[model samples]
Target: MAATIEMPATRRPIVVAPMAGGPSTPDLVVAAGEAGALGMLAAGYKRPADLIAEIADVRERFTGPFGVNLFVPADASCAPERVDSDSAATGVADAEGRDRADRVAVEAFRDLLVQAAPDVHVPTPDWHDRDHYEDKLDIVEAARVAVVSFTFGCPQPHVVERLHEAGICVLVTVTTEEEAHTAVAAGADALVVQGYEAGGHRGTHRVTDAPNQLDHLALLPMMTDVGVPLIAAGGITTAGDTRRALGAGAVAVQAGTTFLLADEAGTTAATRMGLTDPRLGSCVTRAFSGRPARGLRNGFVDRFDALAPAVYPAVDQLTKPLRARAAQRGDIDGVSIWAGAGWRAAREAPAADIVDSLTP
Candidate 1:
């Protein structure tokens, strides 16, 4: 029988979820590590060189083991077909007199942006956005970080083998039991069982598939039979939630929303405002990133969720400028306030303090 994967020794069985965009920071990872929790650096939208630099920076601050999370590129079989250039430019309509969801949404949003903030310039969207998956993998192999996790999909077999050779533990985030099986088959050292309530992005292997609404606490039991270490993610707030996850056979609980307001996190002013604002509520919407992600519901999502296409990084790129402009203006309604259901419990304290409070 294959040996069971052993998680890193720590005072608490809590892991700080890697928050892409800006929340995951070196200080945040270092603080979590110092407090006896595993912390992850997000490499989703980073340049390979920049990712390496961030790794070096984290090592400088915290000597303990930490993790790096990467967004695996969409497999060719599942890559979204690019809409025709002519149709995209002309905003051609079908027999029903409705243009493609992606084109229409982009145009409408762009027009709104132009009217809302005429002086702000929006950048053109890149239809192909892989986030440099292969280059980032090479950096991880060279950095020799103790743990490397993949979201969006399981890494290819050879990539897993290479990381394993370098003494790096491979973790694959799976939103379903089927995805868990696939990751185990791909030789993943551990499984991050991300449930429907996970903030940011659902780690489902297929972007086209709608995420099944399963609580991570409930999903933990389903993945225990996978025979590997399971890290439960999503809506873990109080010590009670942690105990429940451990009771269900999860070796650790991963919490992102709980740490969104951590002092060390790079969460922006607008995002922090939205997170703490009592009026704000959370829901899953594909408007911002073109993938199902849980976040504080806002005007942007309300206006575009139904019209946004299932094309990721493309949709992510399409909305970048608008989000950037909104962020610059400190407009909470325009920025993507990615948060899980447990966001209300997030506290504005040191990452270590948050770790201590959650774990104990």
Candidate 2:
């Protein structure tokens, strides 16, 4: 593989998108640096303590540049605005059958949440105000990490500025033009424009806001409004996809789904085994995290989409145990198997081989 990359140190454009709940391991981050691409340690699911340990481990192996990807804890989801009426939301029922159906769905959903979380990912440090956001930032700053990227939502302006003052470049993942604009206004150094095909959760700024209905090709053109260096992510499975995104005006392309099965990645045996099944394709479900994310479709999601609320961290916690139990038993019915549209393109060689092949 020609491991040649055309970007300079300051403009080291290619990024290995951080996939939480396994693939974003310390060794993988080191591999990215060796492969001539930047890597982000997925902070989306880790406790600050666990994340700190991983950060230290990466530093132990690779003294060069790397990044930390956090999930910006939404101010409101952890403490949602009171709903004035239940009739307007997901579980309004006028008929007995409808009521019964909703109840059955709710129980199934509880089961789904538990099943989905099996050592599954968390959206943030657990929740806002309590997720220890400040401490995590301070710890990463102490490590002198080169970049701090965020998903789920944009951090407060002051938080971004603080990391910037610490000399850390801040990149926020955005799924829509509106989000990109907001991130820029809030002090993002770069924008990770995530199109719908992105494997994990789409980082729509508003948890309530519906994700934009654009494919990568259509979405690529609209990112021009962001006014920052664009790094397109999601559904990039081949060298051709990479070429297309860069040609479409992305300064660099970010990838996650491609690394799900990489040798150095932390992907679980269940995910790797299920990927080869051919029966489990990808679909978006709010079952694991309160947010809608794409993952392998199985018995769990087949049973629980309608009852899963838009409410995130709460659902994330409520279902954690079940997901854990499922994974322990190697049951695909309950574990969250995140993947992108390019699942078929996933390879089994070492992450270094995969990374070297991707760069131009």
Candidate 3:
């Protein structure tokens, strides 16, 4: 039997979105918690040992409730199969053939990266990399964090049962009504309905499927019948946005872009400048990570968005060094400046102040 664990109530109807790749730092998490919002640590790209250290760091500074977000591995079998002329003529392509084609596409993208950023050394894609999913799960369950949220894909029923057994609540990010139903059936304690305007990667369950363009307000009403607590995400940047989401049936709201400029966030200087720059506009592009994510449109995105393949971590790995180099040099055009539609409204402030301002 699955053990029951209730979602911890926060002083405000706000959750600090777990912005992976850098923004979600221990200080930011602690600050969000102190300000009466639930802060989640992004365990997406970190090693298990590093995740353990972070959990300890958060525990030491703040005894308040927090959560950890994980990226479930994308199923390779479900990857979109590209049918070439030969396969098209035959009208039949086996799994092995499709796998080969996918590899070829990824390789071609790598070559393009090499050309685009000649100074950066792009690594070959580790096709089987699972982002240490199993190891991270073991670490988080052992750590016994208050909430465990998942993105990319839903965890298996047994996995959810195990987390429940550890007395940990589980939240699953869903971008559509179907995903919301799937998460509920998988025994999620809550749902984070991420909308089209969200910054960072869209949490679509299937890698090949284009994320739905439904805004959170329109999407939230469709989820009220799912029988789980709903946390609306996506362009939620102010107290008014919070009220609208709650009015739409969300118990709380999750926001990341609004806090990109928060004093405690680990957002890079280049990204900080990009977010505040008046000339840049936000758009969903696959240029940086192969996955569709909303960010400030810049030269890199303008040049590579159309050429990138739909292979994550693979593309993400290829661009990591280039992004790092750009950040080190404080070049906003070269780094991925992820931000939501409400990014223009974001201002530099302490996370606690941001949380207060977001609360009605």
Best by lDDT: 3
User: Predictions ranked by lDDT, top down?
Assistant: 3, 1, 2
- What C-alpha lDDT do the candidate models reach, one value each? 0.84, 0.74, 0.89
Which residue pairs collide, candidate 2? 114-322, 114-323, 115-334, 117-120, 117-323, 118-323, 118-324
Worst 10 residues of 2 by lDDT: 1-10
lDDT (tens digit, per residue) of candidate 2 on 1-360: 111112225234578888888889998888888877887898766789999999989888887788888776776222122344576543333334443554455455565544645455433223334356667888887886888888778887777767777777878888877677777778787888887888878787665566876766677798776667778888887777878888888888899888888888999988887787788988888877668888889887777666686666666666666677788899887778888878878889887777766665
Determine which window of 10 residues in candidate 1 has minimal summed lDDT.
Answer: 76-85
Q: Residues 1-360, candidate 3: write the lDDT tens digits.
A: 585578998898899999998899999999999999999999988988889999999999999899999998866122233455466555455656666877898899899888877878899888889999989989999999999999998888788999999989999999988888888888889999999999999998776678788899989888899998999999988899999999999999999999999999998899998987888998999998888899899989999999988877788999999999999999988999999988997889999999998998
Clashes of 3: 0
* Top-down TM-score ranking: 3, 1, 2
Question: Which pairs of residues have clashing backbones in candidate 3?
Answer: none
Which number leads on TM-score?
3
Q: Write the per-residue lDDT of candidate 1 for residues 1-360, one digit (tens) a residue.
A: 233345668788999999999999998999999999999999999888889889999999888999999998876222222344557544344312332565665666556546755776755666566788888888988988889999998877778888888878889999988889888888888999998878999997877689999998778888888878999899988888888888888889999999999999999999999997888898999888879999999988887778777767767876788899889889898999999988889988888888887784
With a 3 Å backbone cut-off (N, CA, C), the pairs that clash in candidate 1 are: none
Model 2 local distance difference test score: 0.74
Pick by lDDT: 2 or 3, better one: 3
What's the lDDT for candidate 1? 0.84
The C-alpha RMSD in Å for every predicted model, in order, reads 5.5, 7.3, 3.3
